[model samples]
Target: MHVPDGFINAPVSVAAGAVAATAVAVSLRGARRELDERTAPLAGLVAAFIFAVQMLNFPVAAGTSGHLLGGALAAILVGPYTGVLCVSVVLLMQGILFADGGLTALGVNITNMAVVTVVVAYAVFRGLLRLLPAGRRSVTVAAFAGALLSVPGAAVMFTLFYALGGTTDVPIGKVFTAMTGVHVLIGVGEAVITAATVGAVIAVRPDLVHGARGLAVPLKLRVDGRLVDAPAAPAAPVPAAARSTRPLWISGLVTALVLAGFVSYYASSSPDGLEKVAADQGIDAKAREHAAADSPLADYSVKDVSDARLSGGLAGIIGVGGTVVVGTGVFWAVRRRRADDLTAAATAAPSAH
Candidate 1:
């Protein structure tokens, strides 16, 4: 959830900021191992896709709506470290550009929506994979379960944060109950979207699915009087057509544009799980205005644009474009840094004269 300013006291907010910053720093190092030439670009696409899908909020209850938190989907597609970075990028773009989340509470949003969701979802997913059958289908199943739980897990984390640094004197127990209850319903939507997206990617390019890797069971062969493992066969050369990610990337970008630019117009006009709970529980009593509330693209609408559809559409397109550009730049820089590190290490090696 996008925690706005004033919900948490300044002290806890700053502490959460430190936590979020540390998580991002750690993820930068961890993502180096996860992102390669093939997956680095996909990581950027994943962030953009998450940003697009979040615009299409679906109705969860009569007056409550939910959108993709995207932790499980990103983790399943890329690795967890990269997954955290992906969601963080989307949150960053939304906060600074769209004013969807508060700048002062950026750390709270990142901690709950990025760190908590990614860690919980990926942990559940990996645990399920270890216990269940190793197959594409199992990956989808685990993804659903992982996503289903991550939403409530984030809710719980937010509740705890609020309990510690809540601006108002609301009942912590009541808030926790409401937050978890609504988010559990929201989690259903998260699970379906995550499973479908993961299934689609697994179908097209299983190699690109970080969670589905190493799923090919090894073969056993009968030898003379003893059983032995079969030697691994060399991989066949893939044609340029099959090897290229251009098609997938193009299709995904187009789909994101369509969703954000057009389909988002029909999304439910209701409060999301967090907003509903906050309003109901008086958590918004002290909520402060967003610092960028007067920004041209604030509130997901372009400034001075009379047409609702036009204003929203332009804002969505701009958000998607900004997220893609920033995400790609970050991922490419990380990838380049890795390559540079390797080159420097090789150069520093001792000469064996």
Candidate 2:
């Protein structure tokens, strides 16, 4: 959920900002182990894809809608650390460029939507994988379950944050009940989107999917009437063309463009789960205007564009483009630093010897 300004007080908001900052710092370090040549670029595309899919809000209830939170999907496709960064990037872009989330409440939004969602979803996903059958289908199933729970997890976190710093004096129980109830319905949409996306990626390039890695069960051999683990097969040399991620990357980028640029026009126009809950519970009584409200691309529309379709389409395209560029730059930089560290260690080892 994109927590707007005035919903949380200055003290709690600042505290949440510190928490978000620490989480991002930790993720940057953890991502060094997660991002590599094959996965780094895909991580960027994942962020863009999440940004695009989030635009296509689906109806959850009569007047409430929901969209992909991307935590479970990203974590399953990439890794949890990188997934947090991906959602954070999308939130930042939306807040600054689209005026969708408030700048002042950026920390609160990041904590709830990025850190909490990623942590909770990935934990559930990994736990389920341990108990479920080892296969591509299991990955998809776990993704669905993780994504389903992540939405309500975020709702609970937001409720706690509001309970501490809410500007209005609304009943805490009411807020929690309404937030969790609606988000559970919203979670179904999240689960479907996550499972489908994870399944599709696993089908095409299971190698690229972090959560799908090591899914092949080792073969067993019976020797002298005793069963024992068979010798591992030597990895096959991949063809250069087959090793190229270009095809998948290009196809994914195209799909994101289609969804954001055109398909988003058909998405439900109703308020999302958080917005509906806030309005109903008087949580927005003190909500302040977004600082970027005056931006040309504010509210997901181009300034002075009369055609709703064209303006929204352009804004969506711009958002996807900007997110990809920024996200790729960030990920590539992280990858390069990791490579540099390895090279430095190798060089120092020779001198030590």
Candidate 3:
């Protein structure tokens, strides 16, 4: 659902841009509470992982394909605010480097893909968690349900935007029906990927999964016909080396590289859900060329690279590397700001006393 230029009129596009900017600003503040020393680096890896997985588009219909939107997966693994930022970073990178999404219509893309998906999916996920059994499986289940819904939610949002500012005169009802119908099929793919990824992370390091935290029920004991909380067991001492997140980080980075560099070559070549719908419904009648189309890495192909495989592989690797570096720097700065704020508050509290 990378909205290209000229799809939306200038007035609506500017309004969408303002909305995206405000959402990003709010998310930056919220992320200060979500990111800390432990999760900040993990958040960066999550962005890179999402970027890589998105490259492996799976067939949804005969001629339509779908890929991971990453909103539900990222929110479940990290937090919603950070999740929005992660997808935004990927979109930004794709727009400027890969010429995938339109630079002019970036705000529209972010509003639909980042803001709407994250907001809706996280709400559904947390709401389900309250009703479902408290366990790792429940987290995975809720993630699937949330992801399933988020795709359609985004489709609806896009339809509304098109209704207001669509360049063509396609019927609103038809656009809505087609967009929602196709995206629902695409949502199935999103759900499976989100659930599997969430389940895997919960299995290895439940502590790192934000949604899986606090799911462990405390032990109970019955004494004298009355139930009481059992004494907490002392945690086994972990070696300093074992406690380091370096291994997990390295493993995640390697996995992203493998998927983007090689596995993506086998992904379906068909157009994705949005592209298919646009072409079929005449939504792209006025679509303009991407500004970055002349870039060396445009269209995921490296300039002067003779081998198609090698060129695509190099571009993927570069994208993953650049995303990780930029994302980590952004998150690290946010984390440091939080720490500084805490220190300042502590200093002022003593002076007030």
What RMSD, rounded to one decimal, does every model reach? 1.8, 1.3, 1.2
**Model 3 lDDT tens row, 56-111:** 99998999998888899888888999999999999999999999888989999999
Q: Residue 202 error for model 3, in Å?
A: 0.9
Candidate 3 Cα errors over 4 Å, as ranges: 222-227
- Kindly list the per-residue Cα lDDT of model 2 for residues 264-342, writing each as its tens digit: 9999999999999999989999999999889999989999999999999999999999999999999999999999999
Could you tell me the TM-score of candidate 3?
Answer: 0.97
The C-alpha local distance difference test score for the whole of candidate 3 amounts to 0.92
TM-score of 1: 0.96
**Looking at model 1, which ten-residue stretch has the lowest summed lDDT?**
344-353
Clashing pairs in 1: none
Q: How many angstroms is residue 9 displaced in model 2 relative to the true structure, after the best TM-score fit?
A: 0.7
What digit string (tens of lDDT, one per residue) describes model 1 on residues 151-219? 999999999999999999899999999999999999999999999999999899998899999999778
Give the C-alpha lDDT of model 1: 0.92
Overall lDDT per candidate, in order of appearance: 0.92, 0.93, 0.92
Clashes of each: 0, 0, 0
